[model samples]
Target chain A: MSVEAVTAENQAPPKPRRKLRNYLLDPQFQMKYVGMVVGVTFVVASVLGAFVYDFSTSLTDSMMANELLLDEYQGSASFQQIEERARAFDRFVLISIILGVLSLVVALGLTGIVVTHKVVGPAYKMRLLLSEIGEGRLSLRGRLRRGDELQSLFVSVEEMVDRLRAEREEQIDALDRAIAKLRAGDDRDQALASLEAMRDQMARSLE
Target chain B: MSVEAVTAENQAPPKPRRKLRNYLLDPQFQMKYVGMVVGVTFVVASVLGAFVYDFSTSLTDSMMANELLLDEYQGSASFQQIEERARAFDRFVLISIILGVLSLVVALGLTGIVVTHKVVGPAYKMRLLLSEIGEGRLSLRGRLRRGDELQSLFVSVEEMVDRLRAEREEQIDALDRAIAKLRAGDDRDQALASLEAMRDQMARSLE
Candidate 1:
């Protein structure tokens, strides 16, 4: 066998990376995204609703806002008149508020689902990676979804795993040496201390 | 055994509630849900685009359209004369078109994200469930998200898993009987065969 191959065999595998979570898999981020969407949706819905209301009642005095395009505020109604208007629109206002609340709740639920998916998707990928590692399949290198916040952590994990793999190789080398000098799985209880002391010395010298 | 202890072991677990996804989680349902959102979004965007385009320009065009009100129809000059008048407000017309397209794109992107999230979230959950089962975590249950279209399939899978677990327990019970009857690992092969045969017979009977 080539000397290079022999050397390579003796070397520990690069440790797998330090463990990192997938960013998209993060429940928190997913929830935040969902919240943002819901907020935006609510704002858009409210604006659209306001516009529709304005269009429907454009001809009426009630349709127009008290603050017009002009600089001055229009105070057209007396207290009695305002009371009459309030009574007239009481039912409409109540119904409108209820409808708005219902819409908001529905939108929030939907946004929550959307966010949960984003968080869960990345999480699944992470679980898959972890399982691979647990099964001693460390050679598996796969791309996580880009822009995941957990990318840095994952990268660090991968590096740590690689380093650990290298250390494992070193440990195995030391074990092989001990086995070659003695017996495999041999009970060394009698010479345990002496053997370990000698082995440590040899390992330090080799390093 | 005390009545309470007997009840604890023998009492049946409450049937898990069926989610819409469990009730409906299927490829066909997924496609339908995605299709509905996609279709509605496309239709909404298209209609809104057209309306925004038509309404914005027509806001002023109504002046020209009302010939009797404008009184500028017959007395107006040649085609060039009308062209000149139209050109005066062409910038606003162009602006409206641009705004319409921008809004259309934004609307489409939002729709795409929402639909994608809905489709992929459950898929991720299913993936995790499969992984857990593969790793000998047979007791793991899938959590179906709300509004998932594969409810029936989820329910069916859950039932299948339960049946499988029960079958496994029966097999293990039979295996224990065989092992107990035998004295050594040397006869383990025969014991395993008998266990398998017994399991097969049980399966056939069930069928």
Candidate 2:
């Protein structure tokens, strides 16, 4: 391939850097969002926990009553035997609830990190690019990591920079031609005409 | 105030709109997020429900056995009386669980809307402004609603546009002066020198 093609390819915005260190550039913002996720998850877990405790107590009472009625009618084994079985089941259920809540908390926390990272990372990249552009660096491009939110906004910003660069080049080219006409010892009328045309071109571009 | 001050104020970017209608621009993305919230909540509820059922059955069995042992030893009461109380508690607990889960679902759904709107609304505004800038309307500014998530990024973008507008005005002003010098019947040598200087100024601005 030609050298021009290679240069153009090289100039294409680099694939967004995805170093692990850079991924959490806006940790405070991400943290606030994650906290919201965790808050919601906690609400669900706590309410469910209350419901489980109450329902378990009620169901256990009924089961014990039925066992006693059977024992009294049939004159079966001692009450202690039935009591042991019921207590064991109670311990098993409580353990299950504890494990379930722990798993939910961990899962939600991880998901919160992944979701907020997509937003915060893109916002951080865009802010840096805007600052560079503000400082008159027209060649810099806006790029976002893959899976970032606001892809359309990034594309529009890149196009805005391209237009600004193109307009600047056009203005400079017009000025160059006007300057050359004056230096070439052109007649007064011709030189004046060139300058006016250049002026008009610049005015039109601003409009 | 001077007219210039008033003009400057007028040119200052308008405050972004914060209408409620505009805030839900990307409902599809927001819906997917809300769906995830609901899914996680559902998992926690289901697990808790199973645990409650097992635990309640176990505890009830033990309670009935103990009560039967007491009655046989002391002739305290009948099994029918205990059965009524157990059924009453079961009904109360089941109703409470139903109410608890319903409230949780509603609360989570509302939270999902609020969290997703904060993200979606800002992204929508930024995208719209970038498109206007891309189309050569450099005077247009980037503005965002207050309390938006990416406020810093939006401020940077607005400043970038301000810089672009100022540079364009400066270049046009330089071109106008050079044009006027060429037209004013000035010495040809002086006019050429001025044009060259204007060209350099434009070049520097682009750089």
Candidate 3:
């Protein structure tokens, strides 16, 4: 391989740009939250929107009634102006309600995903590492993102693996000494074989 | 102890009512989400409230201007009615904005805590278990609540611990066989001592 290629291979791979699916590492967990917040906001907005509608409608009706009472005293141009203004107010309220609810859902949904990703992303990575450990591989080789939740948990797992690796080394050392001592003794082939088997098991686990 | 008390001791303690502190198991993590959702909602509400205010004010101003034009044609009683209606609409809009934003914050905040709690609670419990495992206690106990996030991750850790315990047992079994064989061989005392030491180390890790 070229020197630059080898150097690149030795270095950690470049971090991937986070995809939409990545932000939703645990969608059920995140969506349950987003749904509740958006749901509540929608209800609240609807109630207030209704109140604004009712109040404005009353104001418009009373204004129209006044315009009707003055029909004999006022021009048709004035009546048209009042009716047009009421319609404009109603249209504004309708637009506000639709736009308000739409933006709230979008904002809350994005926040929910980003927030839950911090917790779920690290957990997803740790679980993969953990399953490897379950399969007898103690040489763990990954880390959580800097801002991920559960950093302390990840550290504990790393420490546990380190301790396991250290304990295995000690067991192997002791096995080596025992095997050496057995080699010097008479008719010790069987004991030496067992010791070697135990060492090999420990050695395999370390990888 | 009475029979009832003894039974109670053997049984798992009653699950505590989830406290506010428990819901906020990781305040910094949970709040970042709640704050973002609430902040966005607040900003959106403010912009829409401003739009509503501007729309209403222009409508009221035009009506008031019409009332002034009609002043020469009508009595002060009609003018009073239009002005009062305009002020009421203004008051209603202001109340809607305040109440809407207040309730939105309250609703989103509660939802944030409850939702993040599902993920954080399990993680918090698992971290404690992991640290215990780090200290060489492979016999894990306790489980995540049914609705909690990361159930699969918890299962993986449990499996890893079980594997480690099983490996330790096999290592101990091998050591036992080696020590027995060494006991039968010449000049085997030193070898037996090393084998016994290795077995003891493996046995200690199982706890």
CAPRI grade of model 3: acceptable
DockQ of 3: 0.31
Best by TM-score: 3
Off by more than 4 A, model 1: A1-207, B1-90, B97-105, B134-137, B141-152, B184-199, B202-207
Candidate 3 lDDT score at position A43: 85
Between the candidate structures 1 and 2, which one is better when assessed by lDDT?
A: 2
Listed per model in order, the count of residue pairs whose N, CA or C atoms clash below 3 Å is 33, 10, 0
lDDT of 1: 0.45
TM per candidate comes to: 0.34, 0.68, 0.78
Candidate 3 clashing pairs?
Answer: none
Retained true contacts (fraction), each candidate: 0.00, 0.46, 0.48
* Candidates' C-alpha lDDT: 0.45, 0.68, 0.73
Looking at candidate 1, what is the lDDT of residue B48?
46
Interface RMSD, candidates in the order listed: 16.3, 4.1, 6.8
Q: What lDDT score goes with residue A145 in model 3?
A: 78
Residues B97-161 of candidate 1 have per-residue lDDT tens digits of: 45544443455345435544454555546555544444334444657888653344345335534
**Candidate 2's residue-wise lDDT over B40-82, tens digit each?**
7666665655555444544555566666666776577798876
Which CAPRI quality tier does the interface of model 1 achieve? incorrect
